[model samples]
Target: MRSAPLLLLLALTPPLLRAPEGNQTRIGPAWSDSRNPIVTTFSGKRLDLWSLRPLTKAPPKRSIDAFLGTTNARTTDKRSLARRLSFDLTGLPPTQSDLASFTTAAAYGDKLLGRRSYGEHQARLWLDVVRYSDSNGFDWDEFRPLAWRFRDYVVRSFNADKPYDRFITEQLAGDELVAGKPKTAADQDALLATSYLRLGPWDNSAGLFGEANRVRNALMNDLVETTGTAFLGLTMACARCHDHKTEPLAQKDFYRFRAFFEGVTFRDDLSLALASDQEPLKGLLVTDGDKPPATTHVLAGGDLNQPKEEVSFGFPTVLDPNPVALCKPVREKSTGRRLTLARWIVAKENPLTARVLVNRIWQQHFGEGLVATPGDFGYAGARPKNQALLDFLARYFRDSGWSVKKLHRLIVSSRAYQSTQSPRRLSAEQLRDAVLQTSGQLTERHGGPPIWPPLPDEVLKANPAFLDDNKEKTKSWYPSPPERLGVRSLYLVQKRTVAIPLMATFDLPDNAVSCSRRTTSTVAPQALTLLNNPFLTDASLVFAKRVEKSPEADKVAVAFVLALQRVPRLDERRLCEDLLKKHGIPALCRALFNLNEFVYLD
Candidate 1:
């Protein structure tokens, strides 16, 4: 029988950030070349640009500057350039103030440097790869109020510019790396990082397998998929039932890889949750999803229900190019199988591991990857958009000991990363939230339980979910007590029952599995969210209040600083004064907060 959703919470993949991959592949959008080109920045599309675009089209500013320098007629169209640049930087539209800043800067050949008023700007791509879900997905999508812990963990990690190596080890073998046999608080946090293991859907409703073996296979699949994507850049799912059809991996290789985690179980969950009457609730009480003893068989149809030839566990041959004979553990019961498996997956000789993670880091900053498909690096997948560059960056990641933060600095500091945002705009979530923040409405509070913001009556009615966001009536996604409404989006309680419509429109997944990329969709529903969503309305008003909340030592200046994180220019000041004069302070503040300038970064 399926466990309670709470129990599943202790089990399931991290929430997926999501993407338009499946659709994007079918529709085939051109590889965007909006970024500035620097030798230091290696998005493969640079060389592919002319081939993809009309040759007659004018070149990007960075391209013009590179060829002819500023002295040449590297003329840029202002309106298009500003809109394009703003969208790229902040994920929002432009406002009068934004135009003012950009025009002033543009005149001096500095405007396209990118905007500084990013509202919740940067988006992390790896979360989807890891398959992050706040709620534990099971028979009934249950609410995990504290799943936000992991969500916040990821956001904070990105915000802090956490190093990649430590991040990986902590999640992969966090419990293994702990100092003592008994994990400590620090050790547990690291171990909990492996909560990455418990993510995925389990079809245990039939109660078919021996209790222990099902958990074992479920956990093993997690370990394998996670390793394949996070490191090797392969989709081990190809190897699950048979030899990989296209990739060099053979069916035996899949089993061999499975051999490593053959003995793992849901009970091995490293991040066991604790409970209390404390101010902020912690994780749901849980045990490591450790498995019990079981046999390894080549399920005739890869079906646990079917009996076939019995097979001893071993590593996949595709990974083992040299081919080592497989061995089972000495323990009569379950093998400490995953321990050995994790060892081999992270081994240096394995070519794909380091490359995959490095590619991910690159994808995070540039909005694209050396290998556009982060999880699938096989024959069916697109070749590395730039193989040489992918290899170079991979080697750098491996040689540098997987320092993610170092890579970020290396990237962001580059003129390429710091280049203007153009052509494409940021996602709607970024727009709304960032606008609120830039308008001086972003809440500074960090961790604790997730809170429910208001929900749409139509959405609720359409879905027929009786759950109340304000109460635990049916485990609302953000059912935090009224007092705790200010938690980060990461802190919002997760329920697979129904996603926030705007978020779903932005391609927030069902949280059923780890998703590597979230798709960017331009739809009218999003416009509706901006225009009428209670959350957006509240954010605008809250931002307005925050700007005016302080005593008047230059209320407008304080407002601008809080909203835009910068002082208001004369033009902006005049605009605000006119707005206040026309509609009064509250209306003007509300209007300014709605401007694209307040939300976008560039």
Candidate 2:
């Protein structure tokens, strides 16, 4: 005999157990232990999931190519290699001079890694994974003015080549890293890093009932899901409603993992003095809300109204069978749950973090990770083609002081990395920045507040509320000054309601959730955006002017080198010359910008 609530839950069970139209078997409900509901264990076979097992302890290999078991991988041409290295490291095309002065790939990679542009480019990837945005996502999409500091902090961390373990610790528990108020810029940066916790889309609009609890639960869910995907490479959120269908995670595991963040709440009014001027800067960060955490429960069907058994702070049993013990903080301002969880994630014994991070770096360079599904290293995710190589890189990354730059050097120096492969489409930011760079109009400015570039009238009218209504300036989108507009697209304001036209056309992630990888789509609008967008038109004109400075006969070769980082082939030279003669240099430049070669890496 079951309790009335349990019977009701059975009746209200979600469609997860229902059979498909053609499938005869109906899946059963998730098993729940009556005596110890939170202590779920997996079968031996389930525990053997490759990603769930401990990382291989094989002796370090001499070279990455050695793991591939290929002695003679064909290297790309020096020109293509130079272009690839430039874009992979710095998200820009190589200049005309770069093609002529090509050196060994290792030296070029090291030089590019040290540039500030490397941080700017790498930070964009991190921001996408964390879903950084300038506005709250739901209706009334209010602006978050101080969120840009987190963006700048990420850029600085990458530029400094911050250790991966410390990076994880800071972002996850930066608010708790310091005892009292932040005194130095380093302390302020730690607090700013905690902004990663608050980067998910938020809804704080008025007039909603149960808004407080609803918003809190939604935020916690986001935090748990993002942290799991971003750090553990697991789809832990799938178990929220019931046990995960494929993975070993139980519903109780979701609640238990979430309990670590049960006390987190936003602190929007933190005042920290800047190291340069001692000026007070307001901070937006996550904290323990200066109160004891509420009890976390496994809600029936993940509904807040139907809370079941309470769960405490613990990791997934599949990963760590032993329960984590919490220590009382000397200062009672925080529960210290996040710091504990952060340390556990970066612990040497943990198999997922270093592997996941190394896979991401591999993905950035090769256009696909060894594990193709970066965020889902679970039963259903694609298995790594070369597990040995993945393990070697993971071990190397961890043993080398967890230095991302060192890992990058090891990877890009490998013959496996430099070998010719499929072309990768330029990311939205990369495309925009490349156009500006080719035009010699890129501002190359360091971090500041996000810029708002001019939008087409149609785009503005599509979201009329984003236009200035005279009553509220904060709710509107105003274009930055012309001088500032040429800054890299990574610095552009990301409004949830109104995406920049060119970015949306080119598949910018919406920032609604953590994006493991951006989808690449070839569509008519992308062509239209490239040809007709005012920014592109302006850039094309600027590029034409730059090309016109060359001798008339050499303009085609000059444009090819500037845009594609290669000399024009005989056939390409003739076609481009005819086009250049028919229309002005601007039209020739526009045509070059629209070419697949200009927007992809060989």
Which candidate comes out best when scored by lDDT?
A: 2
The regions of model 1 sitting more than 4 angstroms off are: 1-126, 149-166, 178-183, 202-223, 268-292, 321-336, 421-424, 427-429, 439-441, 458-478, 481-483, 549-602
Best by TM-score: 2
lDDT (C-alpha, whole model) for all candidates: 0.50, 0.82
Find the 10 residues in a row with the least total lDDT in model 2: 30-39
How much does candidate 2 score in TM-score?
0.91
- Candidate 2 ranges with C-alpha deviation above 4 Å: 1-45, 206-210, 274-276, 327-332, 467-472, 551-553
For model 2, state the Cα shift of residue 195 in Å: 0.6
Clashing pairs in 2: none
Model 1 weakest 10-residue run by lDDT: 10-19
